[model samples]
Target chain A: MKEFKFLIAIWKTNLQSAMEYRGAFLTQTIGMMVNNFIYFAIWIIFFDRFKDVRGWGINDMYVTFGILASSFGLVSLLFGNAFMLSDIIAKGRLDYYLSLPRPVLLHTVASRTIASGMGDFTYGLISYVASGYFTWDGLARYILAMLLAATVFVSFLIFTQSLAFWLGMMSNFSNLVLNAMLTFGIYPITLFDGYAKLILFTIIPAALMGAIPAEFIRAFTWETLAQLLLGAIGFLALAIITFNIGLRRYESGSAIQTEV
Target chain B: MKHFAKYWSIFQITLLNSLAYPGEMVGRSLMIIPFMWIFYQLWKVTFSTAGADVISGLTLRDTLWYLMLAETIELSRPPLARTMSENVKDGSIAYILNKPYDFMLYQFSAAMGETIFRALVNAIFGGLTVWWLVGAPNHPEGFIIALPAIFGAWFLQFCLNAMIGLSAFVVEDVSAFTWIYQKLAFIFGGMLIPLNFYPQWLQTFAKMLPFSSAMYGPVYLSVAPSRELFISVMTLQLAWITALTILLIIIYRRGLTQLTVNGG
Candidate 1:
């Protein structure tokens, strides 16, 4: 409860800071929405010529894009610091978190919020509703899927960021991995098979982000739910373990820098 | 002679700096594969669904090879607009202006240097993937035409990006413009879907735009080339290059006049 309250307070402050530059904040959010819209437009164009790809139609894309966008938005909106972890580590900026009273990793991950995430979340909800498949049961499955998807996204980021501790100056490589994962997640998972699908479900977890969730929502099955649950827990555990181990080797530069 | 030396020096330095991160370059190039793979499957399914030997004058092999080449064009362009926007936003562009070199020329040289390296790496990887899996382009004769056509396409992209970057003098950031232009290029320039697949009106509209010169012209030459197509493609590319270069010059001049600096 206390942690939740603290997170709320942090977001409140972050929102206030963002509001200081109202125009720029609005631009960022709207730009992201337009960016995502263009991608959807391309898919629509594809479907216009061909009815479907392997039983997956434009409607399925709406679901896939919806789930992926919303979960990504949630992570960016609530845990924006996760994306910047590698940069923070490279710059030796973890000292402030360590000095604070709360959990360093948690605080570090939830310190900032991205205004664009609001746009992404809004777009996702609209897309999902527009797909004409929303239901009470679908909503429940969607919620569960969001939890698993967001966990996988944050965990993957943490796992990559932790590499900065050992590798040092890993921002570029970390960014490349994250970009590849994001690109993979936005597409239909049915498009890949065999070894590619296996990699997606395991190392990258792109399946958890969109496909499995969309499938489970289409047809609620305990088996799929169990798989998602196991994947989330296993990935989260790996992230936490890697981050903790990396934390031990962290060396502070003792340079004073303040971020509001 | 001095001007050439100045630009050459900037190009050499930028090229050397890119070499320092060869691993990152290769990793960046590797990103094209997943995109190719996804498109490969989608096209396979698309062909099977259509139940036709050719759609829009392209066989399955032709479409896949076109995609590979299209992706190479997409991935190779330098982020010149972002670099310029950052330099302008931070007021570092003022520092560059104070130096002996021409600011626009310096930016162009730096972009060209990095772009050449990136294009080569992307082509090698993208080409290898196509050969390893999809064999080769259906039109081998078009490969010879694509060499100069692709380079012409890159120059056009550089000009467009330079103009956007120069707009930072009036706007807070040009990144929004960049995002929009990229999508426009992807859609109208036939990055994934060929321009011929579009309706007649849309294809005509796309042909008139410079974005088509940047992507469609090169990829079109690679998959389906004729003497008339070659002449038209090269002519359109040269014309756009000339037009955009003039626009870039005008923008740089006006942008410099309106520039404001803090701590003056």
Candidate 2:
């Protein structure tokens, strides 16, 4: 419990430091917002041309994009620094977190918050509201889906970052992988057939992260809900295992002392 | 001649530096391939069902070949002529300028070397993968006709990117310009979808724009390569490259003069 408090303190301090750089923080926030808005524009063009793609209406596309944007936004807001996990590990900055009296993973994640992520969150919320897909009837399911989506996204970061143990320069690799997944992954999973769908659900988990959960809410299916729950659990387990194995390989040295 | 040799040496060093990071090179190349493949698959589905034998004068095969060629070409081309634009803004350009070679030529050569290396690797592996999976273009002449046109496209793109980078001289923030240029390329250059897929008016407008030469013209050359088409596409690319290159030289000279005058 004390460790948890310490972790939270660390997060607060980092956020405060970031707030000090108001100009950079604001620019980055606006940049992320504009970056996400462009894709929304592209989707508008897509739906404009084809009224419905594989039974996916404009409304459904908006929901998928919103859920994805929001889920990614949530991750970025709370654990945006997690994206830099590979870099931290590579540079032996993990030693600082390890020395702290907290779960290293928790400390690592809580160390930094992205002010820019607020832009993504704001854009996503606006998109969801604008899509008019949100109704009180499906509110519970949407919230649940958002929670599960966040879980899967966090699990993905953990899994990818754990790769830093073996791959020294894994940050760029992780970024490339994550970007590809987000760009190609958010579409209707059903558009993909056979082994492609299998890969999306299992290896990349893009389907489960964005598409499946949104699909579940749109057309509530016990089967899909179950799959999502199971997938989240499975991914969490995998990430934990990967992190533990990486921890075994981690060498605790005075690397952070020099930085200090 | 001495300057040329120094620039050549810098290019060689850059190439060797990239070669040292073989794992990164391979991983990035592998990562990009799947996304390209997905684009191919999506376009195939879109074209397969459309009853119109020709969508904007492009047949199904033409469309598919266009996609394949564009994916390969986009990967092969360097991201910018002035990747060091940000470096200039942050004053790291000072270290680069202190080197024996001209800073502009050194960076340009480095970008070219990296692009050449990526193209060779991507072509041999990525080309075969696409060919084996999607099958080669129906028209054999298409590949031959596209070769020179593709070169022109690369040159034009490089010049335009350099121009965008040159904006650093005037603009306090050039990153926004870079972002806008890349987004424009993705949208207007037909990287997202073929220009034919756009409305007829938009298609006409896109073709008239310089950005289309980077994307649409090469795709057109690859899918339906005729003597006349090749000449027209290459001529336009050459015109843009010459114009942009001259503009770049002028801006660079002016920027340098200002830098010296201000002691920046």
lDDT of 2 by residue, B188-226 (tens): 788767776777777787788888887788777778878
Tens-digit lDDT string for candidate 1 (A100-193): 8998888888888887887787778778888878988898888788878888889988988888889887766777778778778877776788
Docking class of 2: acceptable
Segments of candidate 1 deviating more than 4 angstroms: B262-264
The count of backbone overlaps in candidate 2 is: 0
lDDT of candidate 2 over A65-109, digit per residue (tens)? 777877787788777767888888888888887776678887787
lDDT measured at residue B124 in model 2 versus the true structure, 0 to 100: 58
Displacement of the residue B151 alpha carbon in candidate 1, Å:
2.2
Error of 2 at A259 (Å): 7.4
Tens-digit lDDT string for candidate 1 (B1-264): 865998999999999989899988987888777777777777877888789879999888888889888888888888989988887788787788899888888888888789878878988888887777678777888878888989888888888888888788778487777887888888889887888777788789988999899999988898898889889899989998888888889888998898775422
- For each candidate, the alpha-carbon lDDT, in order, equals 0.84, 0.73
